[model samples]
Target: MNSFLTSGLIHAAFWVVVGLTFGGAVLAVFPRKIVYNVLGLIVCLSGVAGLFLYLGSFFLALMQLLIYVGAICVAIVFAIMLSPPLHLEVPKRRMGKVVLSAGASGVFFVAIAAVIWKTVWHPAAERGADWSIVTIGHLLLTRYDLVFELISLVLLVAIIGAILTTGFSRRLSS
Candidate 1:
Protein backbone atom coordinates (compact mmCIF):
# COMPACT_ATOMS: atom_id res chain seq x y z
CA MET A 1 0.00 0.00 0.00
CA ASN A 2 2.79 2.41 0.92
CA SER A 3 4.72 1.59 -2.29
CA PHE A 4 1.62 2.14 -4.42
CA LEU A 5 0.93 5.47 -2.74
CA THR A 6 4.52 6.59 -3.25
CA SER A 7 4.43 5.61 -6.94
CA GLY A 8 1.18 7.47 -7.43
CA LEU A 9 2.59 10.59 -5.78
CA ILE A 10 5.72 10.46 -7.93
CA HIS A 11 3.63 10.22 -11.09
CA ALA A 12 1.51 13.17 -9.96
CA ALA A 13 4.61 15.25 -9.20
CA PHE A 14 6.09 14.48 -12.62
CA TRP A 15 2.96 15.69 -14.40
CA VAL A 16 2.86 18.79 -12.24
CA VAL A 17 6.44 19.66 -13.16
CA VAL A 18 5.72 19.11 -16.86
CA GLY A 19 2.67 21.37 -16.57
CA LEU A 20 4.70 24.08 -14.84
CA THR A 21 7.37 23.95 -17.57
CA PHE A 22 4.90 24.31 -20.45
CA GLY A 23 2.74 26.90 -18.69
CA GLY A 24 5.75 29.02 -17.84
CA ALA A 25 7.04 28.74 -21.42
CA VAL A 26 3.70 30.01 -22.71
CA LEU A 27 3.68 32.86 -20.19
CA ALA A 28 7.25 33.80 -21.10
CA VAL A 29 6.54 33.99 -24.83
CA PHE A 30 3.10 35.66 -24.74
CA PRO A 31 3.76 38.41 -22.21
CA ARG A 32 4.26 41.97 -23.48
CA LYS A 33 6.01 43.21 -20.34
CA ILE A 34 9.75 42.48 -20.05
CA VAL A 35 9.49 41.85 -16.31
CA TYR A 36 6.69 39.33 -16.86
CA ASN A 37 8.85 37.55 -19.45
CA VAL A 38 11.80 37.37 -17.04
CA LEU A 39 9.59 36.09 -14.22
CA GLY A 40 8.09 33.52 -16.56
CA LEU A 41 11.60 32.41 -17.61
CA ILE A 42 12.52 31.90 -13.96
CA VAL A 43 9.36 29.86 -13.47
CA CYS A 44 10.13 27.81 -16.57
CA LEU A 45 13.71 27.17 -15.42
CA SER A 46 12.46 26.14 -11.99
CA GLY A 47 10.06 23.72 -13.66
CA VAL A 48 12.92 22.28 -15.73
CA ALA A 49 14.89 21.82 -12.52
CA GLY A 50 11.90 19.98 -11.06
CA LEU A 51 11.86 17.80 -14.17
CA PHE A 52 15.58 17.01 -13.65
CA LEU A 53 14.72 15.98 -10.09
CA TYR A 54 11.94 13.73 -11.40
CA LEU A 55 14.44 12.09 -13.78
CA GLY A 56 16.50 11.04 -10.72
CA SER A 57 19.36 13.43 -11.49
CA PHE A 58 19.78 15.54 -8.38
CA PHE A 59 23.05 16.99 -9.68
CA LEU A 60 21.43 18.22 -12.93
CA ALA A 61 18.49 19.67 -10.99
CA LEU A 62 20.88 21.54 -8.69
CA MET A 63 22.90 22.82 -11.66
CA GLN A 64 19.71 23.94 -13.46
CA LEU A 65 18.67 25.95 -10.42
CA LEU A 66 22.17 27.28 -9.77
CA ILE A 67 23.25 28.22 -13.29
CA TYR A 68 19.97 29.04 -15.01
CA VAL A 69 17.62 30.13 -12.23
CA GLY A 70 20.18 31.47 -9.76
CA ALA A 71 22.66 33.14 -12.07
CA ILE A 72 21.08 33.84 -15.49
CA CYS A 73 17.60 34.86 -14.31
CA VAL A 74 18.99 37.04 -11.50
CA ALA A 75 21.42 38.67 -13.92
CA ILE A 76 18.61 39.38 -16.38
CA VAL A 77 16.52 40.96 -13.62
CA PHE A 78 19.45 43.16 -12.58
CA ALA A 79 20.08 44.15 -16.18
CA ILE A 80 16.45 45.10 -16.65
CA MET A 81 16.46 47.18 -13.48
CA LEU A 82 19.74 48.91 -14.33
CA SER A 83 18.63 49.87 -17.82
CA PRO A 84 16.43 52.93 -18.30
CA PRO A 85 12.94 52.95 -19.91
CA LEU A 86 11.42 50.10 -17.95
CA HIS A 87 8.03 50.85 -19.50
CA LEU A 88 9.08 51.29 -23.10
CA GLU A 89 6.20 50.70 -25.47
CA VAL A 90 6.58 47.66 -27.68
CA PRO A 91 5.73 48.00 -31.35
CA LYS A 92 2.83 45.92 -32.61
CA ARG A 93 4.04 42.72 -34.25
CA ARG A 94 3.25 42.43 -37.94
CA MET A 95 0.98 39.70 -39.22
CA GLY A 96 3.54 38.68 -41.83
CA LYS A 97 6.21 38.11 -39.17
CA VAL A 98 3.79 36.14 -36.97
CA VAL A 99 2.76 33.96 -39.90
CA LEU A 100 6.37 33.36 -40.90
CA SER A 101 7.34 32.48 -37.31
CA ALA A 102 4.42 30.08 -36.98
CA GLY A 103 5.22 28.42 -40.27
CA ALA A 104 8.88 28.01 -39.33
CA SER A 105 7.98 26.60 -35.93
CA GLY A 106 5.58 24.09 -37.51
CA VAL A 107 8.21 22.94 -39.99
CA PHE A 108 10.85 22.56 -37.25
CA PHE A 109 8.41 20.64 -35.05
CA VAL A 110 7.55 18.26 -37.89
CA ALA A 111 11.21 17.71 -38.72
CA ILE A 112 12.10 17.02 -35.08
CA ALA A 113 9.14 14.68 -34.65
CA ALA A 114 10.13 12.77 -37.75
CA VAL A 115 13.71 12.43 -36.51
CA ILE A 116 12.57 11.19 -33.12
CA TRP A 117 10.17 8.72 -34.68
CA LYS A 118 12.80 7.40 -37.07
CA THR A 119 15.58 7.06 -34.48
CA VAL A 120 16.01 3.72 -32.70
CA TRP A 121 16.63 4.22 -29.00
CA HIS A 122 18.80 1.60 -27.34
CA PRO A 123 19.35 1.39 -23.61
CA ALA A 124 22.69 0.23 -22.21
CA ALA A 125 22.85 -3.59 -22.43
CA GLU A 126 24.23 -3.90 -18.92
CA ARG A 127 22.80 -1.25 -16.71
CA GLY A 128 24.95 -0.31 -13.75
CA ALA A 129 23.25 -0.88 -10.42
CA ASP A 130 25.63 1.53 -8.77
CA TRP A 131 24.43 5.14 -8.68
CA SER A 132 27.29 6.93 -6.99
CA ILE A 133 28.54 10.55 -7.04
CA VAL A 134 31.97 9.38 -8.22
CA THR A 135 30.41 7.56 -11.17
CA ILE A 136 28.46 10.68 -12.14
CA GLY A 137 31.58 12.83 -11.86
CA HIS A 138 33.58 10.44 -14.01
CA LEU A 139 30.87 10.27 -16.66
CA LEU A 140 30.48 14.08 -16.75
CA LEU A 141 34.20 14.69 -17.04
CA THR A 142 34.85 11.94 -19.58
CA ARG A 143 31.76 11.35 -21.72
CA TYR A 144 30.17 14.80 -21.44
CA ASP A 145 33.44 16.69 -21.69
CA LEU A 146 32.25 19.35 -24.17
CA VAL A 147 29.10 20.10 -22.16
CA PHE A 148 31.13 20.66 -18.98
CA GLU A 149 33.51 22.98 -20.83
CA LEU A 150 30.62 24.94 -22.37
CA ILE A 151 28.99 25.36 -18.96
CA SER A 152 32.25 26.65 -17.55
CA LEU A 153 32.58 29.09 -20.45
CA VAL A 154 29.06 30.37 -19.86
CA LEU A 155 29.80 30.86 -16.15
CA LEU A 156 32.98 32.77 -16.98
CA VAL A 157 31.06 35.07 -19.34
CA ALA A 158 28.38 35.72 -16.73
CA ILE A 159 30.97 36.61 -14.11
CA ILE A 160 32.81 38.93 -16.47
CA GLY A 161 29.57 40.64 -17.51
CA ALA A 162 28.62 41.17 -13.86
CA ILE A 163 31.98 42.71 -13.08
CA LEU A 164 31.84 45.02 -16.11
CA THR A 165 28.28 46.10 -15.34
CA THR A 166 29.14 46.91 -11.72
CA GLY A 167 32.19 48.94 -12.70
CA PHE A 168 30.24 50.79 -15.39
CA SER A 169 27.44 51.60 -12.93
CA ARG A 170 29.94 52.95 -10.39
CA ARG A 171 31.59 55.12 -13.02
CA LEU A 172 28.24 56.50 -14.14
CA SER A 173 27.26 57.27 -10.56
CA SER A 174 30.56 59.02 -9.81
Candidate 2:
Protein backbone atom coordinates (compact mmCIF):
# COMPACT_ATOMS: atom_id res chain seq x y z
CA MET A 1 0.00 0.00 0.00
CA ASN A 2 1.05 3.60 -0.67
CA SER A 3 2.26 5.67 2.28
CA PHE A 4 -0.46 8.29 1.89
CA LEU A 5 -3.31 5.76 1.88
CA THR A 6 -1.82 3.84 4.78
CA SER A 7 -1.35 6.96 6.89
CA GLY A 8 -4.88 8.12 6.11
CA LEU A 9 -6.32 4.76 7.07
CA ILE A 10 -4.48 4.80 10.40
CA HIS A 11 -5.63 8.34 11.10
CA ALA A 12 -9.23 7.46 10.32
CA ALA A 13 -9.11 4.46 12.62
CA PHE A 14 -7.62 6.52 15.46
CA TRP A 15 -10.35 9.14 15.29
CA VAL A 16 -13.11 6.54 15.09
CA VAL A 17 -11.81 4.79 18.20
CA VAL A 18 -11.38 8.09 20.01
CA GLY A 19 -14.94 9.15 19.23
CA LEU A 20 -16.36 5.87 20.46
CA THR A 21 -14.34 5.96 23.70
CA PHE A 22 -15.22 9.54 24.63
CA GLY A 23 -18.84 9.20 23.57
CA GLY A 24 -19.23 6.14 25.76
CA ALA A 25 -17.59 7.96 28.67
CA VAL A 26 -20.03 10.85 28.23
CA LEU A 27 -22.97 8.48 28.27
CA ALA A 28 -21.67 6.69 31.38
CA VAL A 29 -21.25 9.86 33.42
CA PHE A 30 -24.35 11.72 32.24
CA PRO A 31 -26.95 8.97 32.43
CA ARG A 32 -29.38 9.12 35.32
CA LYS A 33 -30.18 5.45 35.51
CA ILE A 34 -27.62 3.15 37.13
CA VAL A 35 -28.32 0.40 34.62
CA TYR A 36 -27.58 2.76 31.74
CA ASN A 37 -24.41 3.86 33.51
CA VAL A 38 -23.23 0.23 33.74
CA LEU A 39 -23.97 -0.34 30.08
CA GLY A 40 -22.07 2.81 29.22
CA LEU A 41 -19.08 1.55 31.20
CA ILE A 42 -19.17 -1.66 29.17
CA VAL A 43 -19.25 0.33 25.94
CA CYS A 44 -16.40 2.58 27.07
CA LEU A 45 -14.34 -0.47 28.02
CA SER A 46 -14.95 -1.97 24.58
CA GLY A 47 -13.64 1.21 23.01
CA VAL A 48 -10.57 0.97 25.21
CA ALA A 49 -10.08 -2.55 23.90
CA GLY A 50 -10.16 -1.05 20.39
CA LEU A 51 -7.48 1.40 21.47
CA PHE A 52 -5.35 -1.45 22.80
CA LEU A 53 -5.67 -3.07 19.38
CA TYR A 54 -4.62 0.16 17.66
CA LEU A 55 -1.62 0.36 19.95
CA GLY A 56 -0.58 -3.10 18.69
CA SER A 57 -1.34 -4.95 21.89
CA PHE A 58 -3.83 -7.58 20.90
CA PHE A 59 -3.37 -9.55 24.12
CA LEU A 60 -4.03 -6.48 26.25
CA ALA A 61 -7.10 -5.74 24.15
CA LEU A 62 -8.38 -9.25 24.71
CA MET A 63 -7.62 -9.03 28.41
CA GLN A 64 -9.43 -5.69 28.64
CA LEU A 65 -12.52 -7.20 27.04
CA LEU A 66 -12.39 -10.29 29.22
CA ILE A 67 -11.66 -8.55 32.51
CA TYR A 68 -13.64 -5.36 32.24
CA VAL A 69 -16.56 -6.10 29.95
CA GLY A 70 -16.90 -9.82 30.63
CA ALA A 71 -16.00 -10.59 34.24
CA ILE A 72 -16.35 -7.23 36.00
CA CYS A 73 -19.54 -6.23 34.26
CA VAL A 74 -21.11 -9.63 34.80
CA ALA A 75 -20.16 -9.47 38.46
CA ILE A 76 -21.72 -6.06 38.73
CA VAL A 77 -24.88 -7.41 37.13
CA PHE A 78 -25.01 -10.19 39.67
CA ALA A 79 -24.55 -7.79 42.54
CA ILE A 80 -27.36 -5.62 41.27
CA MET A 81 -29.61 -8.64 41.04
CA LEU A 82 -28.72 -9.70 44.58
CA SER A 83 -29.26 -6.27 46.09
CA PRO A 84 -32.51 -4.91 47.38
CA PRO A 85 -34.95 -3.54 44.86
CA LEU A 86 -33.89 -0.23 43.39
CA HIS A 87 -36.18 2.76 43.47
CA LEU A 88 -37.98 3.26 40.16
CA GLU A 89 -36.86 6.88 40.22
CA VAL A 90 -33.55 7.90 41.78
CA PRO A 91 -34.15 10.61 44.33
CA LYS A 92 -32.37 13.87 43.58
CA ARG A 93 -29.72 15.16 45.94
CA ARG A 94 -29.86 18.55 47.61
CA MET A 95 -29.31 21.47 45.21
CA GLY A 96 -26.21 22.64 47.08
CA LYS A 97 -24.67 19.17 47.11
CA VAL A 98 -25.29 18.75 43.42
CA VAL A 99 -23.73 22.12 42.64
CA LEU A 100 -20.73 21.37 44.85
CA SER A 101 -20.09 17.99 43.23
CA ALA A 102 -20.41 19.43 39.73
CA GLY A 103 -18.10 22.31 40.51
CA ALA A 104 -15.47 20.01 42.05
CA SER A 105 -15.56 17.64 39.08
CA GLY A 106 -15.34 20.52 36.58
CA VAL A 107 -12.35 22.03 38.34
CA PHE A 108 -10.64 18.64 38.43
CA PHE A 109 -11.26 18.20 34.73
CA VAL A 110 -9.85 21.61 33.93
CA ALA A 111 -6.73 20.98 35.98
CA ILE A 112 -6.10 17.61 34.31
CA ALA A 113 -6.74 18.99 30.82
CA ALA A 114 -4.46 21.96 31.38
CA VAL A 115 -1.63 19.73 32.59
CA ILE A 116 -2.00 17.36 29.65
CA TRP A 117 -2.24 20.16 27.10
CA LYS A 118 0.71 22.10 28.48
CA THR A 119 3.03 19.13 28.78
CA VAL A 120 4.83 18.42 25.52
CA TRP A 121 5.21 14.67 25.22
CA HIS A 122 8.56 13.91 23.65
CA PRO A 123 8.75 10.49 22.04
CA ALA A 124 11.58 8.18 22.92
CA ALA A 125 14.76 8.77 20.91
CA GLU A 126 14.69 5.18 19.62
CA ARG A 127 11.40 3.37 19.95
CA GLY A 128 11.34 -0.38 19.48
CA ALA A 129 10.21 -1.58 16.05
CA ASP A 130 9.05 -4.90 17.43
CA TRP A 131 5.44 -4.66 18.62
CA SER A 132 4.58 -8.32 18.83
CA ILE A 133 2.71 -10.28 21.52
CA VAL A 134 5.52 -12.83 21.64
CA THR A 135 8.00 -10.11 22.62
CA ILE A 136 5.61 -8.88 25.30
CA GLY A 137 5.26 -12.35 26.75
CA HIS A 138 9.00 -12.94 26.79
CA LEU A 139 9.74 -9.56 28.29
CA LEU A 140 7.12 -9.94 31.00
CA LEU A 141 8.16 -13.44 31.87
CA THR A 142 11.86 -12.65 32.03
CA ARG A 143 11.85 -9.23 33.68
CA TYR A 144 8.53 -8.65 35.46
CA ASP A 145 7.09 -12.11 36.01
CA LEU A 146 6.07 -11.70 39.66
CA VAL A 147 3.37 -9.17 38.83
CA PHE A 148 1.77 -11.58 36.39
CA GLU A 149 1.49 -14.35 38.96
CA LEU A 150 0.22 -11.95 41.65
CA ILE A 151 -2.52 -10.65 39.41
CA SER A 152 -3.75 -14.15 38.65
CA LEU A 153 -3.78 -15.00 42.35
CA VAL A 154 -5.76 -11.88 43.13
CA LEU A 155 -8.32 -12.67 40.45
CA LEU A 156 -8.79 -16.19 41.73
CA VAL A 157 -9.41 -14.94 45.27
CA ALA A 158 -11.89 -12.33 44.08
CA ILE A 159 -13.88 -14.91 42.15
CA ILE A 160 -14.00 -17.25 45.10
CA GLY A 161 -15.08 -14.45 47.44
CA ALA A 162 -17.79 -13.26 45.12
CA ILE A 163 -19.25 -16.74 44.95
CA LEU A 164 -19.08 -17.23 48.69
CA THR A 165 -20.67 -13.86 49.41
CA THR A 166 -23.52 -14.45 47.01
CA GLY A 167 -24.06 -17.97 48.27
CA PHE A 168 -24.06 -16.96 51.92
CA SER A 169 -26.50 -14.16 51.25
CA ARG A 170 -28.88 -16.55 49.55
CA ARG A 171 -28.71 -19.03 52.45
CA LEU A 172 -29.32 -16.28 54.98
CA SER A 173 -32.25 -14.96 53.00
CA SER A 174 -33.85 -18.35 52.83
Error of 1 at 161 (Å): 6.9
CA lDDT of every candidate: 0.83, 0.81
- In model 1, how large is the Cα lDDT of residue 47? 100
**Residue runs of model 1 more than 4 Å from their true location after superposition:** 86-174
Return the lDDT, model 1, position 21.
Answer: 95
| All candidates: TM-score | 0.54, 0.53
Native-vs-model 1 lDDT? 0.83
Q: TM-score winner among the candidates?
A: 1
Cα error of candidate 2 at position 110, Å: 44
- Model 1 TM: 0.54
| Candidate 2 wrong stretches, greater than 4 Å | 86-174
Cα error, residue 110 of model 1, in Å, equals 43
Best by lDDT: 1
